[model samples]
Target: MPTYSRFLKEILSGKRDCDVKKMINLTENCSAIILNQMPPKLKDRGSFSIPCAIKTLEIGNALCDLGASVSLMPYSVFTKLEIGDLVPTNITLQLADRSVKYPIGKVEDVPLRVGKFIIPVDFVVLDIDEDAHVPIILGRSFFATAGAIIDVKQGVITLKVGNDSLTFDLTNTMHYPSSPSENCFFVDSLDPLVHDMHEHLLISNDPLDLAILNREGLGNLGVEVAKYKEQ
Candidate 1:
């Protein structure tokens, strides 16, 4: 059976007897945090990668982006999930390169399964490039709510949920494609055009200085400078 069909069937089936929200409470010792750590790799190519689950379905390629304010997902993924009903939003996202893309809208109550933790967040649906390698973009919205701690050197992302720390390793899954900057985050042009007034040209405050260039000839040259009296 298709994943989407199953999801809809379950939704239509009925609500389960549960608290709904993933809950966590800590003790006085703070022993609940185990310092979720990943094994040190012989050759660690630091990349922000983590496994994300939507409706308990693991998203193979999910990129962890700290620069982004809100979590984002391609509209294509939304269509694949067959999730219905999204709130209308008029938000404009500015790319790293300064270009902007408008999102279709936002879907509330979207829970992302990160490790054993359930991250309740919203995603702004947008039309992403079809060729985009990463299907899901985990932005700061998830990070802040999840209390994520990413260790770049160790290539690990850990989320402190309640008293447990859920971890995902990047060394095994994240692929560092050639010229990644062009693929994921927008790359700003190093050389930007700077505008300034040409220094060589100067205006004469006194028409006496321009007396050398006859005003009569200036009219013939299709050039005239406005004269102002010194206050």
Candidate 2:
């Protein structure tokens, strides 16, 4: 059995040595940051929840998920709106959790009144009956426009609109279940090299403390390999 420290080391080294199953068990049960191990009171402490409204209807806690490409507005919110001009769209969407298809109507530019600001946003209308809590999903569109830095661990969402800034307290935060078997690995993020280490994660100690994120994928595999060798 691998200890938490050992597993952490393996992850840093990109060493996928342990069997998938055992590696997950160690992370799920013994990790210091295990979600289920936290006190119930601290569950909502680290979240990025905010309130938005359309006309008189209060849109529930809008989850700012940077992963999602499109902002989702449930049918419930559309029904509450005093005015909605649904343009005809032949768009079919496959939600994250399910494989079933959702018939999407035309996008609506909904004027959302968030705090002191009135931001008009284009929302993809869909019936999200599957999701129990999230009524509105603020995707990349919101982040790009608002310039929000969503730090989940610190439980802070700092939004920068030009020179002005605003922060919101999260309510009904997301909780991670002890389901290591389901999610075991994370995608790699390249940061500026501070120290040269043997781990493949960082090739070498470079004078520049910044590295470009691997967004282009394996297309430049040979170049990356040569860079690593040179380092």
Model 2 ranges off by over 4 Å: 1-47, 130-132, 175-231
Q: What is the C-alpha lDDT profile of model 1 across 111-207, one tens digit per residue?
A: 7776678778788899886434577777887888888888777777788977898877777765666345556666565443221212112254345
Where is the poorest 10-residue window by lDDT in model 2? 207-216
Clashing pairs in 1: none
lDDT of 1 at 34: 55
lDDT of each: 0.71, 0.64
Best by lDDT: 1
